[model samples]
Target: MELTKGANAALDAGDVEITVSWRATAGSADLGPSLDVCALRLGADGKVREDADLVFFNAPSSPDGSVRHIGRTPDGAGEVVTVDTTRQPADVASIVVTATIDVVTPHLTFGGLAVSARVADLATGAELARFTPPPLGPEKALVVVELYRRGGSWKIRAVGQGYASGLAGLATDYGVDVSADEDVSAPAAPLAPTAPAAPTAAVPAAAAASAADLPSTGDPRVDMRKRLDLRKKTVQAVLTKQGIPGRQARVALALDASGSMRALYRAGTVARVVERVAAVAATMDDDGTLEVWSYATEPVALPPLRVDFLADWIPLYVRMRKATTGQGGADATLARERAARAAGWPIPNWDAIGGQNEEPKVMALILEHYERLPSPPPTLVLVLTDGGLYRDKQIAELLRRTAKLPIFWQFVGIGRARYGILEKLDTLAGRVVDNAGFFAVDDLDAIDDETLYQRILGEFPAWLRAARAAGIPL
Candidate 1:
């Protein structure tokens, strides 16, 4: 049935999926479309069930298992949030769903946003109802719809309510800690939408007491997907500009697991990088799984991480604090075991390898894997680190040779450490092609996925053409 403003309907469907979609053109030049799905649990009085019951991006799901916020759609196309009617907590008498303007134009109001929402039954996937709110009054936020328990039945209401105060005001109505992001900037960029707290040594304490307080709308995978989609044309355009056609390729990640980088791992920067890489791999690789390795001395191939398992990737390994550091070096054996339990994703076991910040081994393994494939696919390797690698000359020599292989290296500098050789790689001479590139960010958390992925991929197309012209096997 069509839903009009302030109209309500009894939703007899047992389990339902609600998707919100909109077509918005910003009135301000600096403004971008940044909207969010917030699920507010309410008690009998209809205020709020409790502070912890507020579900959005950071806290993706309600603890009671009733609500699940699937990642956002790209460029404000839309979003999906699921509700299992029977699973809602006993105390949650109502679930108020709101769409809020996160950080767009200062004057953006719900009335200006052409928005619509639809509810569908999960089991049969049948459309239960849909509502397209007209130009709302002057509110930055809108109470689009609400599902509540009424006389032993479930019902959906098209409230068309708008919040003048936007998300901040809506959040304040709930009990989320409304303060500042506490991320102890690593002498780096201000990482927002990710975390709070200073660089502490202990993982558990920081993640619990401070890090979780930071506001975040999307996870690493969702962030990466949106970026890749937005920049698909740009990436294609560049390749065309250089007369370089793109290819389907495998993706890998080389992580720096050294002592100095301990604080970053604890801070969850590395994990976020991995998830984004996995998302990129899903787009590039034949399979969505990515080869993950750690090197301080030598490279240890860890379990290949699939995008599906990325959510649990960090939380699962939080106990393995400093796992990549020189303290234990690299151990694919342990990483593989953990990955094996990833609920049956097609992840390969990592090979056990150990050494001290040895970058060459990572190069060797990536090349070897490509060599072994019946007909190798082109490959891109993302090297995540806070500083430069050892064996500089050997790595340079290796890159010179691999310039003839179907492999390209992108090094991301995570902290303010002098990248002795990495900074100079673009101009280094005597290669079949320029196969290596480098960019630095004080913190990955602060960088938007679009900006980060674009830069990460910027020079790759040129290198691909060079490698192809050099007669590297396709």
Candidate 2:
């Protein structure tokens, strides 16, 4: 088989022709089948250009099949032809073609089972042609082949054959030649090459020192602050871009109610946390959903407490405070022990219910509940915890599995504890960390009402920006 091209000279917008030639052996035996041939025009960057086209030809079954016409060039300067046949004939076969085209980077591609023995001018790594030959025995066969261009050569990149023997010594035979006019303009030179030299030695040191003094790169705190600021800006941009006003930003709040939550309760911080969280939730206007939950082993839905409903909940809140105070110094540990002993649960149940416990079952429940909940208006989950014990790996895996779900997790550490786990949720500092998609506030006690409000308000925008960056829909 021989492949040739028309005059290789053309403008960047000109057309070209490609031709393939082959000979079939004279015989009454079945030559099998033929395949399609495709041509791809590429830009200088090696990406697919606008000028690419494809042509297909069927190999002849009888000696008369040897004279098959593949395709034609209407107005283009060039044409590509393919001789797709399974049986190798003893006679010489040749293809001829022309095209009226200009391609900055030109390449060829073929698909089928036939073995390609040679190619020219085309880089060995380039995808120029493809073909698939029929199977040997009675079993039906299908073959897929594609060629790609490398630095200076064309190479067969992919081949799929079912019930067919692999083509042997296939790469040694193919070639390609790109003929273009010399008049085509070359790409502009890089600016840096012609630019003047930068400052040297003493001057450079001074500039470097100035840049160094401006900011440090490795500081996590500073980095976090920048990331938070950028997140807020991005969120605002998305809201504006989506034409959703700040007041109209429909927000849903889901809080964690596992046993670990009792830590915040015992620290005399749950009420304050709820107060602050509620206050933030109220700012979303009447359009927002403020469904709350107090989950222990399971999630128990709290009424959608509106700002107006806060007055009514105040009595309930007072009763809750009195109930806790009634227990005297009974903290989360004491409460867990009481619950465990009352149920005659295993001793390990106390540890499991404590802040350091891992509750895979509870987490699964939360995930299921979240899945079932009426897609709650671009919701955000605010988990107030002391960074207690939880199935980190299981939770991380679950989160990854459901990553496509649009729920933003913002953890607020409500007590004095090492929030190392929470820090992993911050994307910037935890850049390579697996769970960096979430956010956290580690020092809730140090935050004032204004700061708390700002933090809460800030979360929506930050999360919205993150979701957008991740290509998640609102």
Return the top candidate by TM-score.
1
Off by over 4 Å in 1: 1-247, 317-355
lDDT of each: 0.64, 0.36
Task: Name model 2 segments beyond 4 Å from true.
Answer: 1-268, 314-322, 325-366, 373-376, 418-420, 427-446, 457-459, 469-471
**TM-score computed on alpha carbons, candidate 1:** 0.46
lDDT of predicted model 2: 0.36
Stretch of 10 with least lDDT, candidate 2: 5-14
Error of 1 at 302 (Å): 1.9
Cα lDDT, model 1, residue 437: 93
What tens digits encode model 2's per-residue C-alpha lDDT throughout 219-322?
22232223333333443444454445453333444444444455455564565455445544544432223455544444444445443223223223211212
Candidate 1 local lDDT, residue 365: 77
Q: lDDT: which candidate is best? A: 1
